[model samples]
Target: MNQRTFRTAAATGCALLVAAVGPACTGTAHAASPVGLATARVADAVRFPWLVGPVVVAHRGASRAAPENTLAAVDAAERQGFKWVENDVQQTRDGKLVVVHDGTLTRTTNVKRVFPQRAPWRVRDFTAAEIARLDAGSWFGKGFARERVPTLREFLRRMDEHDLRLLLEIKNPQLYPGIEARIVKELSAAGWLDRQHVRRRLVVQSFGANSVRTVHGLVPEVRTGFLGNPPLNALPSYARYVDQINPQLSKVDARYVAAVHRLRGAHGHRLDVFAWDVPLQNHLGIASTYGFDGVIV
Candidate 1:
């Protein structure tokens, strides 16, 4: 929907921040592989209210200003008055979680130059120490020379000090076995999973259904979103799994959106749909008008 039209439509309707994305779903009763989750049903969810106002989350830590996924990026995001900073995490060989977006180090780091022995295709196969040898920030520009791939702990410690909220994304779970569990462990250690008095605000999202399910199964308190394109796979089944569904906005048209808002839950309906990959400002403004809970570029 166009921004002006969306704004007008939003004004005319009782739009909730979180709406479902597709057709009517069976919700909990449809037969499918169980998410194996005990309901950590969100309380006071409707009371919390959809953030209709502009909420600028710096995608990959103010990536436009600083090197992505580095401390510099995060610091820049905080300085820019962005309360929420986004980043992606992957697992290392030793089961430590590290902040990075790409599967390989070739594009973001000078790994090819320093570790000539390592091929670009297989760099993720390296140990954390081996991965550390590459200069992650220099290519972004010399000012970020000290920036390196940060461990999850290091990032969390900095976030704790800054008191910034996080949009933590799990990138490519299938490649790294046990990564989901490791992430849970890390969050638990840092108290991100605590239901009471949450120290570090977080919203965990993943493209992998299994990864999202794993998070729901283990740490139900953390908000979860399943990221994907739509026409979506199943209305009833997928709806049952996530707290909210995040579909690429371009894929779904205006007609599909209203149906998503009607999605229900076990004790009644409790599903919300958010749109993603909103790279353009007009799209962000439009998504806000469309009643999306949050928009990510």
Candidate 2:
């Protein structure tokens, strides 16, 4: 949203960080994904007490301080003491996973200048090497000149180095067929599906239900969240696949939140709800008071 500044909502006993603007992050409940996953020495996940009041998950790597989705952002979030971080990921033409938020390369990178003929440079149209050559950070500020679009491995390497929890989003899954599986495969190869990471730190999410289900089907052990509010009647069915429901801040209200909490997830934990796109005018503070497990600014 805007450059992020960390402050405590002292009254609510919560830290404020936004995914877009600032944050109230997700807490760790426990330890412990499945796809082409070979048993390897997995990265460790730092644990936090479950049910803590809105945690500070740096939205796009403390976007206020660093370019969103770049290694700089990830490092900034870690430098700023954020325990968790959120980011969107998708595949390149050669099937490598890269961390980025937009479908087109125009917004965050120097794609237009680097490849003048490649109008509307859809991420899918470019090979990883082509995408890698573009400058991803100058648009945010010149201090980050030469910062490259990080592959998911690069991004996760930062997370691993810091032991930060991840709320990885499969941005626009429909644009990349089998992306769900690819993501799982990547995570597995990276040793992210091990018991410690799975039991305590990672949660994969998406607005697409099928994508969410596909992730669940691949690795039932990894916790999952669905990013839209389904009708109340459908919660049980969703519960069979996901551990949380993440709705935009506008759709969240006390009653709906209570209903979500009343259910149990596929893992037998109480269903959690994390609200995103929080409003202004102290509404962000108010949302924390609504008993939401976390608030995504």
Candidate 3:
């Protein structure tokens, strides 16, 4: 794996200044805002030993460059020197876990042509074998026509081979009730729970708070995060079960980041704040200005 670069303080200051002043600033001298100063302080204080700084998480394995949730996408991200990749997982009709992002397959796959009778192609309606036959990448481009929707086991094996960290989101837990336990079982069966290195690299996250709590109870060793723009009053409660709080990028600011850090949970754990769907250019600057622990770009 290759080393990743973080944002420098000078760049962060410039970005924040630009953010504070509208793009139409006409060389007007402005006083430093309280939010800007606080953001810088929080950024300096929130450093972790295992991480260099705010981590760069490739959302959906660099979805902009390749088909989302396919092994080819992950391989592309690895080739680009990204250490952290995020993907979604859901159970098929036969209870087999597959890597996919949508409730239906109309968008990213050739499901309509392959399963012409299976309209509204929900993932739960198909068995794993049925899903494996669908071309997951051709919709993106002809160059990726051979890409397949990889299983959770295949995804993890690829991540391990590349020494990459995974941010695994359990997509639509309500669709597959008891999926939390199933995911834990799958992880254990794959020897992920037995290896210390693998355990450190794995993180389970979900938009459902209950699902996050369920995973925390089932596998306390793996770090978990909740994805949503949760209420400010709910931070303390979320900290009890999750190690990180991943809110929408637009919802994040210095005040929100500080509140998350202040949440003290079991074993004196402070919830790390990560923002999602952040754009590529000036990402570090935005992360620093908002005091994020990680940015899912």
Candidate 4:
């Protein structure tokens, strides 16, 4: 395999990054399993010349390999030669944007132990400074001990250093009112909303249809995706607001894929579809068979 070199800084105390390259690698700075094979081999695959095959996105920065949403997880994705990554973002109590999955800090961080009284430690129930004190990575392993929940700015900086593309999910917009504005503000301040970046390397997605529509109105140039398998009749309306329709792995087939491709997005491009949380190689074969545009694994 051919190889090259690049370095990306891990958040705060983590080490510098060094990722190897191979034929499967497609970075600029750069630089799933099984039995469903018959479905994957279905005839009349939707082929887009822009991509050789379905784009594979590292979920929460390679969650199985590192504590999710931490800089460590992002680096893990880079090390595995993944160019595109998908991570969730939520706002802190002080309205600071942070890269984390859950609306609460319980699962991925040591919030419970740190603030014993802060039961049901809602992410918005604590300040970023307070949340910063918890160990975000130790739950996954000792080597990752002290990994902290990164502020959105910190996460984006790391991603830029690695020259990676991002599919940033607006985790739970309802929990954080005006979050759409806050998110766009942060991305804009980070230079990610620039035409070049927005056009080539960034996407903002939300499970909430209204939140996604709000995002489209805020910055239509920045392509956005709506997460869900809405009824086929809703396709035209959804296409008006989103560039992609990202549904769960179990919710699609060739007919669905073809339906999405037939429409033009708000951005004037073919609407795309990406399945989320897919597991096993057979599923990947099926994505190929069903002609998905991407998969969040």
Alpha-carbon lDDT of model 3? 0.76
Looking at model 3, which ten-residue stretch has the lowest summed lDDT? 23-32
lDDT of each: 0.63, 0.74, 0.76, 0.75
lDDT of 4 by residue, 166-201 (tens): 999998899999999998999989989988789889
State how far residue 1 of model 3 sits from its true place (Å): 22
Q: Is candidate 2 or 3 superior in lDDT?
A: 3
Models, CA RMSD each: 13.1, 10.4, 10.3, 10.8
Q: Residue 157's C-alpha lDDT in candidate 3?
A: 88
For candidate 2, what is the lDDT? 0.74
Error of 4 at 60 (Å): 0.5
Better of 1 and 4 by TM-score: 4
Which has the better lDDT: candidate 1, or candidate 2?
A: 2
Worst window of 10 by summed lDDT in candidate 2: 35-44
Compute the lDDT for candidate 1.
0.63
Best by lDDT: 3
- Cα lDDT of model 1 by residue, 1-297, tens digit: 665665555433323322320000111211111121111111101121122354445667756445678887777656645677778999777776889999988878888887777675353577778777767777655656788888888888887777788878999999887788888899888877765424337778889988887877776666676787435446556565566666787766555655566675222445555576564234345665565656664
| Of candidates 4 and 1, the better by lDDT | 4
TM-score of each: 0.76, 0.82, 0.82, 0.82
